[model samples]
Target: MSCCHAASWLSCARLVQRADALRIIRRVPMPGYDVSFLITAQHLAGPGARQQLVDWLVGFVMECDAEINGLKLDINARGRAVATSLLRSLAF
Candidate 1:
């Protein structure tokens, strides 16, 4: 998790291990658990931008939850299908 503040970002940026990993994270286009959003004061200057940020965050969370649930269901279904097939192939 990120503190989501500039000072915290700076301090974390200073850390050696994190800094190295961060360099890779930046260079590579891969998803990571820790995220940093650099929002400037001007971003909140207008009510529209602020609302958009909130809406986008809400969607982000919802989409993550939905994707996770879908993956779990798919895994369970595949496992059950395999078990059923194995059972049918064997003598009762």
Candidate 2:
């Protein structure tokens, strides 16, 4: 048995490009093992948009049969400053 962990960024395109990107790596086949996924997002439109993104992320996670152990979202951030802030907040 093997365990696989993956991380990806959710974009506004409503697509799971991460899965496609991971296809190459998943071919190895983990038998009777747990898979973990960490997904992040930045610049979600608004509450509604954020919900939509969450829904898409949930579906993507289920499709991959991976447990979402963590999430790092950087909402309403435009550049490096906001990213730094988010990272700082998470550190504490």
Name the top lDDT candidate. 1
Q: Which residue runs of candidate 2 sit more than 4 Å off their true CA positions?
A: 1-42, 66-92
Q: For model 1, name the residue pairs that clash.
A: none
**Model 2: residue 5 alpha-carbon error in angstroms:** 18
Give residue 89's lDDT in candidate 1 (0 to 100).
Answer: 92
For each candidate in turn, the TM-score is 0.57, 0.27
- The per-model lDDT (C-alpha) reads 0.54, 0.45
Q: Estimate the Cα RMSD of every predicted model relative to the unseen true structure.
A: 12.4, 16.9
* Residue 44 lDDT, candidate 1, scale 0-100: 64
> Residues 5-85, candidate 2, lDDT per residue (tens digit)?
333333312233544433222433466644434334442535675666566657765644433333222223346677888
Please provide, for model 1 over 5-68, each residue's C-alpha lDDT reduced to its tens digit, 9 standing for 90 to 100: 4434544444424334223223333466454444566656776867765665565456446656
Worst 10 residues of 2 by lDDT: 67-76
How far is 50's C-alpha from truth in model 2 (Å)? 0.8
